[model samples]
Target: MHDSHSERMSGSETRAASGLALVFAFRMLGMFMVLPVLATYGQDLAGATPALIGLAIGAYGLTQAVLQIPFGIISDRIGRLPVIYIGLLIFAAGAALAANADSIWGVIAGRVLQGAGAISAAVMALLSDLTREQHRTKAMAMIGMSIGVSFAVAMVVGPLLTRAFGLSGLFWATAIMALLGIVIVAAMVPRASHPLQHRESGVARQALLPTLKHPDLLRLDFGILALHAILMASFVALPLALVEKAGLPKEEHWWVYLTALLVGFFGMVPFIIYGEKKRQMKKVLVGAVAVLFLCELFFWQFGNSLRALVFGTILFFTAFNLLEASLPSLISKVAPAGGKGTAMGVYSTSQFLGAALGGILGGWLYQHGGLSTVFVGCAVVCAIWLAIAVTMREPPYVTSLRLPLSAAAVADTGLVTRMLAMPGVADAVVVAEEAAIYIKVDSEKLDRTSLESLIESAPERAEA
Candidate 1:
């Protein structure tokens, strides 16, 4: 079970994973760093309005959602590194444009431009190229953890940056970070030796329709859209609520964010453990969404006091962090073997679209009906997601693994039958062209020794 040789990542794998993680962190940090302070400080811009400000906050999502898939598709045509380099340059340009803009619409344009540089799928593709099939999951996890950290850091740091240097300064700082990301990519990250199109890793254009039509996958996609919409909408009014309703000074806002995020981060750990270990994912997911609903209601009704606002913020984030982590894992669990990448692509698009919708919708509600309406809107969104979650079938607790298969094993008509007969092997597919077998297995019941022995015996059987 603890074979070091089989488990340990090679030196190059470690470097590649770490470098790409840094690149991801840098980009996400820049994107998230605006969320906390934008609604409050963006008023200083010429032509700034609540609606336009909200548009500015969410503009990136629109272009990002539109272009993320296309960028990835083009990466396959040209190359991963070139697409990444071009995306980073575009991101920097957008940041620079925003930094110089004195008007809200200018910032919105800049944000849209920033979104145009979408590179997430390409990055994932490159990561898949760099890592062996056995180590790819761990590498992907590394990137996911980096993103979570970046979000937390941004929440705390964004307010402080705005307080000290104003909105323009923050944009300037993001530009610098984007430029720095380019340097990291060029200097630190290594190129993939064999950039093959992996069905488990890269979206297969032909698989798009089926992935989209998958009922469970569609529900999950809607969940992300609603979740991000709730997030963006809530933030549209939350800063103003903290300042005007709670009487918290603008400069000290970061303290509240830091405290709430810390609570959210640490508080959700137990629930996540319970959910995964107990195999109660659906229950946990529904419970988290319910908590979100209650939190929004609390804000709507009792958010005037500083303590109440802080409490509500903490609760909201606790649920948010839980859902944020759970949704992707669920997507992976629900996706069919050899179709995970396509499922994820759709999920990512829904997430960005939700952000865009939330921003625009939050702004409209705030302008027309005030802060309370924003909360109510988010609550309504949560209710819809809750309904969807309740109807979803309990997801199987399985992990996907890709094992190399010799040509002999692939030629065996009994290969699939034998693999499927193994305990814990829920699903298996033989991809002869890649000389590999992709399997979904329940780790708790899997017998690794037996599985490896079966594969090792294949070549011998062929010779016989």
Candidate 2:
């Protein structure tokens, strides 16, 4: 409704957000640090094969996808920190296992264990617990920024670490980082004063079916799935292409990653501004998918040349960063009222599953048909995604508003109807159990003052 609604965070909100952001960054850094070097270095492991190596690279996603919902459910039952602490311990154990392993299967097993720690939902829930409703979006934004920064940092530093110590050394470092995350959770993050229902933050089991059935949300889910599948599958070939074909040493791999990421980051900004400010998100999104298709074609044709590889990489990351930032925004804009958390949970699961499928499929393609085939597959996926995206409706420019409702308002059958009839309100859900009403409203058209007055005028009575 107004910019001031989220402008300031309380001292506690700041502290909690910062602490949790660091914890999330550390965990993600562990997962991403191996992406650039894994294809090449993993060959030294016993029982290594291209297919097995691809499995190892993507093994974490399999476990992460499987455990994510369970971890969230456990956290809801047992409390957030306990679940987080257990998850970190599992991650550390996985890291240690990977560090000591001599075979690709061992590494895969370790990666699976690492992913089993699945604390993302718990961490977000904890952040929601620590911040006020008005400030929750800003707090979540902090975590999102932390993830982007972590990806950049991992790409730059991962090669350096691997060169200095070796693959096992990198695993050891990840284990150490996981341990550090445990310490941060225990000492740095603030505890909630009491257990919170966290309807806004945690998934509601009942909302799952409806969220899955929503056609727009289903499209977004498939978009993320295709996006990450391409991402993981591409890397199966990209690192090897850099070394064997492009003639870059493994040690110098970071140069390509760092340069490409920097260029891509800068390139993504203008598109994002145009998409948001110009209200041209669908256009930008489809354009990015087309660019992704072109990038795959470039890789397929010109991957052997150093100069072409770099150029294609820059273009690839540019398209990637844009899509990565835009998809979640689209979800928020399209998700039905009271179903945001459920929609997000499904979206995340799709992303992780895509990563796992990408690894497996990419490995198979590379093993049987070579790198060119992998690129061809990725291009085909992008082509399909682009075709589907083109037919989708433009997402409404709406923000969800949560308002406190009196007991009488909760009992009133017409509350949701009245809210939806109000100017700019696109959807409304009234939850009697929580005594709250959630509405999606077009910010530019919303009459905040009138909405407030309407809520104030709603009849009041004690619960029966």
For all predicted structures, in order, the TM-scores are 0.96, 0.97
For residues 312-352, what per-residue lDDT tens digits would candidate 2 score against the true structure? Answer: 99999999989988998899889888778778888888999
Q: What is the C-alpha RMSD of each candidate to the true structure, in Å?
A: 1.9, 2.2
**Candidate 2 off by > 4 Å:** 1-7, 460-464
Per-residue alpha-carbon lDDT of model 1 for 248-312, expressed as tens digits?
88788999989999999999999999999999999999999999999999999999999999999
Considering only N, C-alpha and C atoms within 3 Å, which residue pairs clash in candidate 2?
A: none
Question: For each candidate, how many residue pairs have backbone atoms clashing (under 3 Å)?
Answer: 0, 0
Relative to the unseen true structure, what is the Cα RMSD of model 1? Answer: 1.9
In model 2, which range of ten residues has the least summed lDDT? 455-464
Please give the lDDT score at residue 173 for candidate 1: 89
Worst 10 residues of 1 by lDDT: 1-10
User: Model 1: residues >4 Å from true position, as ranges?
Assistant: 1-5, 458-464
